[model samples]
Every structure is written in C-alpha cells, then in structure tokens.
Target chain A: MTSVVAQQIPYDSAAPYRSLSLNTATTKRWTLAEAVDGAARAGLGAIGLWRDRVDEVGATTAAKIVADAGLRVSSLCRGGFLTGREHGPAALDDNRRAIDDAATLRTRELVMVMGGIPDRDLAGARARVEERLALLVPYAAERGVRLALEPLHPMFCADRAVISTLAQALSMAEPHPSETVGVVVDTFHLWWDPTLADQIAQAGAAGRISSYQVCDWLNPMAPDPLLSRGMMGDGVIDFAAIGRWVRDAGYRGDVEVEIFNATVWSSDGHEVIETMKRRYRELVLPSLVG
Target chain B: MTSVVAQQIPYDSAAPYRSLSLNTATTKRWTLAEAVDGAARAGLGAIGLWRDRVDEVGATTAAKIVADAGLRVSSLCRGGFLTGREHGPAALDDNRRAIDDAATLRTRELVMVMGGIPDRDLAGARARVEERLALLVPYAAERGVRLALEPLHPMFCADRAVISTLAQALSMAEPHPSETVGVVVDTFHLWWDPTLADQIAQAGAAGRISSYQVCDWLNPMAPDPLLSRGMMGDGVIDFAAIGRWVRDAGYRGDVEVEIFNATVWSSDGHEVIETMKRRYRELVLPSLVG
Candidate 1:
C-alpha cells in the first residue's frame, strides 16, 4: 500500500507577505456568521463574502461580525450575471443589492461572473452583456463600488459565464473605464490563457484590474465542477509566474485565496482556511515579495 | 418504452451552401481510401486527410483516389506538436512531411495543435510553443503551406495544447503576419471562446484565416476526452451563429466536419458521412449562406 502524507505547508513562517482571504464558498456548508467567525479565528488576513451568505445572515450583521473580528474584506462574492435572457433585469437588480451589500461590508471589490448565453446564442448574449454593463457601470461608480468582472473558465460558458478570457472581459470593460469597472483575474479561469501576461499588462496600463483570485485546475478531471478545484501548488498552473506578472503589471491588490471546493467547505472551516493560508504563503507569496 | 424515431434529416435538401468536408477521424474505423469512397458515396463535397492515413495509403495514390472520387481536399489533419522539450526537432520534421503531403494532395491548409507543458509548467510550455512556431514559420512560408494554429480548449492545457484562446493565438501569429502562418477556427475548440467573433474578424482582417472546422460540444460531460464530441445540432453550441460570424468575417473556407467520437467513428462510414452531410446542409449551411 502506498501512503501519502499530506502535510500542510506553513505560510506565516516563510511568506508573511501572502495574505489569506477565505472565499465564503470555502465554508459553504457553514452559515455566514460561522464562516466569518471561523475565518477570524483561523487568523486569515481577509475574507470574500458571497451574496447568498451575506443575505442569509443580514449583510449589516455579517459586516459587523467581520469588522469586530478585525478581518479585512477583500472582495464581495459576485455582482454580475449579465446574460441576455433569464437573468437580465433580475441580475441587474440583484447586482444593485450586491453593490449595496459590498458598500455596507466595505469590501474593496465586488467580483462579477459575467453569465453565459441566455438562449444558447453566445454572440448575442455577449452583446447584451456589454449593453447591460454600460447601464450598470455608472450606478456602480456612484456607489463607489468597483465592479470586478470575473471571466469564468470556458467550460462554464453554457451555464455559468460567457466572458471566458481576461482579454475579452478587458475589452468589454474598456468603454466604461472607471475605477468601478475593473476586471478580476482569477488564476483558475485565466491560468490557461495564452495572452494572460499581455492582458494583465494591458489591464494594469488601463487601471482596470481589481482582484486576483487563486485556485488550481485539478487534473484527471473531478466529478463536480465547484468542488474539483485543486489547492494552490497542487495543480499545473504557474501561480508564482502569474503572481510575478500581476505585480509587474502594477496590481498592488490582495492575493485573495478564493477556492470553491465543496469538499473543503464540508470539512472543518478552520482546517481549510489554515491550509490555504499556509499554501498561499509558501507557494504564492515568495514570488510577490521577490 | 420510449419510441425514438431517429430524426431523418436529408443531406442534400437541408442547405444550399452547406458543404461537408470529412476529417478522417470521424471514421477511424475505416481506412483513408474507405473514407474517401464513403465520402464520395455520401455526396460530401470535401475531405480532410490525416498524415498517418496518407502514409498508410501513400500520399500520391491517396491524392489520385480522392481526385478520381471527386472529393475536394479541404485541409490536412495537423502538422504541429511544437511544445515538449525533446519533440521539437522531431515535430518540425513531421510537420515538413505533413506540408509535403498536403502539397501532394493539393490541400489548402494544414491544421496545427500546439503541444502543452513538458513538466506541467503551462507558461513555460506556451513560451516554448511560441519559440518553436517562430522557428518553423519561415520553413512553412517557403513551402507555400498555410499552418493553421488550432487553439484547443483550456481543459487540454496540461496535456494537449497550451494555446487556449483565439485572441492568444492571433497575438502569437501577429508578429509573423502572413497567410502562411494563419489560424484554424475550429468550432469545438473555439465555440466557448468569449472573443471568437472578434478574433475571427481580426484573423480575417489580417488575411490570416485559413480553415473553419465544425463539431459540437457534448453536455453532461463525456467519459473520454478525444471521442466525446457531439454531432452538429445535438449539443449546446450555436453553430449556425458561429458559421455566420466566420463567414461575415471574410473566411471563405470549407466548413470541415472534424468529429473525434469513438461511437460515431465505430459506426458504418457511409452512415456517418451521410448524417454529417445532411446536418451540414440543413443546420449549418443556410445560416452562413444568408
């Protein structure tokens, strides 16, 4: 029998520069209050709260708990589902509510997953997203909330989001160039992008980059989409290289650890948060500091 | 019991402009000669031959058989694996052979699948691929062969191809800027690309668009990576819209049906070719024609 000793890599020791931010999905099994308190107890630097979690425990209370615990709010879970159909007006309304929540929480950024084709016509859906964003940008600007357009993986195109590349999202976010209308570069989504470095530079030059989320794309395929993401340093993505590029591109933002894994969420929140914090410190922080 | 009538879509009456170009993998069960005869029998307008198949049947003899059978050689099935450390020189040699074979068969384009990471470092692999392409571009130019860089799905980033987006590919092919070093806009690989239409437009504007390949992406996930492609109209992809976009972008190339499905390939070649021809005419051709 082959024994695999999965040891936790310590982040606080080697790379204090690497900051840990718990994406609420990491404790999806826990209540919003539980996640916030658990994240604080684990000594994570920050937390990324989801709209649903905030909604479950009133956003005001959630904000108070997070602040009381003295944890930084890195980013709000989401604010965009800019599909043409099913989620058009509803998505916009939801995003407005999300913006309000982020403002109350005092989060630095509101992550947006640009929803995919509403009626299976991708091009048409993309046009609609652009139009919707055009309307939403000014309102977001007014709220002082940055709309971080997060490009989802291409595999998520049909059901999740159509904006599957940093370059595409950057182009869409171009017309409404505001600190409010920046792009979120998630490693899980943008790691495979061939023009990742170039686009990161472009985003930096344009001052449209807002958030940097980290998660690894696991190999041999995982059965579930949400839970299959590998922890940092476990997969094929060159996170160190990406971290270096992001830094070079003038993104002095938080290196948020936003993993969406059901297994991790189902496990002890403290354990998951600690592991992520350690991995971020060891694998990702050194490159940034160097 | 569910009564399934198996929709009978006529091949010839579906679309006037819909032309079928069989990529030999659609009938891996059949020899290259068999595919040619079967394609001719099914009234397919064109066929994309593989280098191995040409080697199996002899390139000169395969050309004669295809010519005698009245089949247009749409494009050859690949000439690039320029990524791995040890395979660079060997890949170049194989590409030269492919170019020679394409020229012998009078095929207009040679599809190239960029290889992925050597040691699981995706960024390094992408840099290697770009370097190798730079080296091979002059040789491909001299041979008068258009090397169509096929940007594969990001899921294939670790094992198949590092180039995962049309935008990334266009940027890589930008510096060279020649008809000889163009791009292949394959529906399966590129359907999820958020910036597909824009990149296709860019490719067309640069006069670097060589081939357009069509195949559907299956949903509910496939167990096998290579053989899980769906038949046109059976999956989530809006092929009609993509076809129109490519056509509008000035890509006047054959819409080659390159399905790599074990189930389809295991079927009678006659039936497979006929069904593809029918679907192309009915579902794909009219959209582009208008």
Candidate 2:
C-alpha cells in the first residue's frame, strides 16, 4: 500500500519544491488557470491567489481548477482598505465577498493590506482599521477564514498600510481568536524591523501566523516602490536569517514566492518558477529543514 | 539693564523666529559664512552646520563667522558612520575630529547617523554600532559633546542608518548618561512611528532630546529617497501635532528646518528662510506655545 501510494503521488512531501508555492502576483501575466497548472506541474504544494486573478475565473471555477491540478490555495491576496473614506455598506459588502471567496477557494488565510491615512490624522486612521477589523472578525470566523493582517513597510504608511510593523499587526490580531484574526510574516516588509524575531515568536506562540510570504527587498528600490520586490536572491534581504526566525517560531507551511518587480512580471512564467525553486532551495529551505 | 540688553539684541528672545534654525543642508549652495550671514539676517538665533560647509571655511573661522553674526551653532550634521567595514583607527580618529569640531563650534549636539549594514548581517551591523558607540561615548563626553543618535527612516537602512527607530536608539543609549548620549526627534524620519509619543516622552523624561529637527515627509517620494525631505507645509506631515509632542516633552530648544528637496535647494536662500519661518509659525509654533 505504501509503495503504491508513493508511486501514485510521484513526489515526496519532504522535497523543497513541494513546500515552494507561487503567489499569483509573481507571474501576474498568468491567469488563475495558468498559475494553477504551472504550480502543479512544477510540483508545488500550493498557490497563493490574488483577488483579481481569482475573480477573472470566478471563485468556483478557480477552486475547481486548483483542485483538478491537485494544488491547494495557500492564501487569499487581500481584504482590507478600512481607512479609505469610501468605507460604508459597500466596504463591508466587499470584505464579505472576499471572505466568502476565501471559503469557496478553500484557503483559511486572507491577507489584509490596511489602507493608508486619508488625511494627516494618522492616529484616527489607525483607529478606523481597528474598528473595521473588529466588525469583519466575526464574519471571517464564521467562514473559517483568518484575516491575516500584513504590516507593510513604513514607507507605505501614507498610501498602502498604516499598520507598518509586525508588533502593530500582532497587537491588532490579539483581540480576536488566533484562528480568526492572524498575521502574515512577509519577509520583504518585515526584515528591517528590529523587534521582528520577538514578534514572530509571539505570533507563533499564539498560533496567529496565517501566511509566510517570501520576496526580496531590492536595495535600490524601484521607482514605483509598489513594484520594488525582487526575486529572493536579487535583493539585499538576508532571507536565511529571517527564514530561520520564521522556522524557529514553529511555522511549517507553504513558502509562497511573491515578487512584484516589473522585470519578473515580463519574464516567462516557467523560467521564473524555475528560478524561484532554485533560490528557495539555496537560500530558504535550509532554515526550514536543516 | 534689561531694556539695554533687549535693544542690543533687536528681537525678543522668546519670539518664535528666535528658535528657528537653518540646517546648512537646506541651503546646500551656501558656504558656512554665507549660511551664518543668511541665518542671522533672517533673525534665526542658531544654525545647524554640515561638516562639508565647515571644512570650506575651516572650523575656527566658521566658528568666528557664526559668532560675529550673533548666531550660535544648534547642532552638527553628523559624527557617526562606525559600521562601515573601512572603519579602523582612522574611523575613530575622524569621529574624534568631529568631537573636537563640535566643541570648537560651541555646539553640544553632534548628530550621529549610525551607518548602514556592510553586508547581509543586520544583527552584526547593529552590534558594531553598539560597540563603536560605546568606544566614542567617553571621547564625546570628555569634549562635552552629546552624540545625538538620529534614526533615519528604515528606507535608508541599507545605505544610510541601521538605527531605524527612536525606541531602538533609546535602548542603545540606555547604558550611557543622558547628557553624553541623546536622540533626535526629526519629524521626517519619525512621523509614522506608532510609539512616537511614548518614545518622545521617554526621551524627554530622561532629558535625551538633543535636537528637534523639522521637515515634512513628501508623499510621492523623489527617486532618490535621500533628497525627499520637503518644506514642512509642502508635504503631508502634521507638524503641529508632532511639534506639540516635542514641546510637551520638555524640548524648548531651537527648532531647525532641514529640507533636502531639489526644489528647496535650488530656491533663493533668503526666500527659503522666509517660507520656513511662515510655515514654522503656522504649523509648529502653536505646539510650542499654545
């Protein structure tokens, strides 16, 4: 029975590539079906889904495609912009739609990019995130989805995420059940933080680490910082150290490669995946299993 | 005697303009002599000197120029870059020169920009900063100069400052006497920190507020993040709120305007000073007095 099962699976779960997952944004040119097929063919265990790509195929069809390819969804791209003035009935409805999609797609994690401040009142903007997140917590819990708060680098505090540190994200997640509200341990956004190791350990102890996103922080950040993330080995980020921190913190999950660089986006998706696999094996895998 | 002193001074010592200072980098075109004349002509009681500008006129002559113009040096631009691999006896010698220059210029605050990591070892680089900082503590103390640790924004962590937060700097400075080591409250670098208020209060209670530098954080940052600092009102920073925090923290010292925007640097120096005064009055003075 064991021999037959090994033959049928065609790959070992212990292999580094098996833990290597692709985030749809890395090969943004690929549609959901294409990403799913590519990830499966590359022997990846999972794929992180961005909302727009999932929307393109429809959540049900996207789920079917992943299931058919034997790949699970590692996480849902995002579901927060609570600080925007447009928040109202439409905002909650949109978040609920994301939660529903996460459940349908069979992913427990929803990455949250808290919106930037609408004005100079930074405190008020942060307060809104807390209030709105609390409102969405119960809804997310019912769907068995966790809102993984992603604290973007402080450089994005004005226009992307007001929550700019793991400490802040962890504090925000503490109020709700760890299963319902969690945090993302994204290397690119977090490597520079002085208190990250402690925070990651704290998150792990509380079981609040919902996603582990990997990418490099380019030394000379791109002109548009939103697209500054590079392939794991292309930037200055010390991935091995951060990887060790994450691994030691007790996280054993899909290691999703999520690059937002224009150069990577323009490259062939297969080649990009091949490079990611090699980089992951060289720079990150040791932290996990070594 | 009071009336005679007021007549000789030609301005009220308690006036807002009296505390307004011009950091020479804001007027990069000006020589030390020129900046001193410009600052004194603008009724600013103090001027922040950059090392390069001081080198041009020689520190002694520059000191005389400032004194002759009835202006004092508020703080020196920098005196730390101890983490560079090139650091050796020469690095300590250069820092000693800076300490000597600070004493000669009659300024006690020596802004210390902790150097960026030389390689991928962030923790190692930070340890080097701690080690080098300790070595220079007694040197600076002997000269009656306080090494004011300036935590640049994390965006500059790779090329500029490894010290990226007031909390980190405070922790690093904890072992030293508050008078020998201090921290800068620069709005441009610190406006986004959630714990800024508490840190500012901590710095104040410990009497570690060496300098309160003011500049706005530009929203769409320039390609070179180093030149992104803008005139206070020209950007999104809530100077009044931040200013109030500094003032309430017991910092009643000179408020220096230190912009590095290309536009500001190319503008007429006198006109720049006039605008700085207006913005400081409208945006920051209330925090100090109201």
- Give all candidate RMSDs, comma-separated: 8.4, 4.8
Which tens-of-lDDT digit does each residue in A1-290 have in candidate 2? Answer: 00100001122436668767899999999999899889989988889999999899899899899989988788898899889665567887899899989888888888999888888889989988999999999888887888999999898898889999999998888889988898999988888889888989998899888888899888877878888898988887898888888878888777889999999999999999999998988888887775
Q: Which one wins on DockQ?
A: 2
Query: What TM-score does candidate 1 get on C-alpha atoms?
Result: 0.85
lDDT by residue (tens digit), candidate 1, A1-290: 11111111233434363366778876778887788788777776677888888887787888888889877778888877777665457778888888888778887488888776656577778887888888787777776777888888887787778888888888888888557688988888888876688989999899888777888877755656555587887778787889888878877656677676666666777787778877887778877666
Which sections of candidate 1 miss by over 4 Å? A1-18, A84-89, A134-143, A175-177, A223-228, A262-268, B1-19, B55-61, B120-123, B134-144, B170-179, B219-228, B248-250, B262-268
Provide the TM-score for each candidate, comma-separated: 0.85, 0.94
Error of 1 at A92 (Å): 3.4
**Candidate 1 lDDT over residue span B1-290, tens digit each:** 11111111233434442256788888887888888888887766778888888889788899899999987788887877888876467788888888777777877577889876766577667788888888877766666667788888887887788888787788788888566688878888888876577888888788877778888887645666566587897777887778778877876666778888767867888887778877877678877666
- The C-alpha stretches of model 2 lying farther than 4 A from their native spots are A1-13, B1-14
> Each candidate's DockQ score against the native complex?
0.48, 0.61
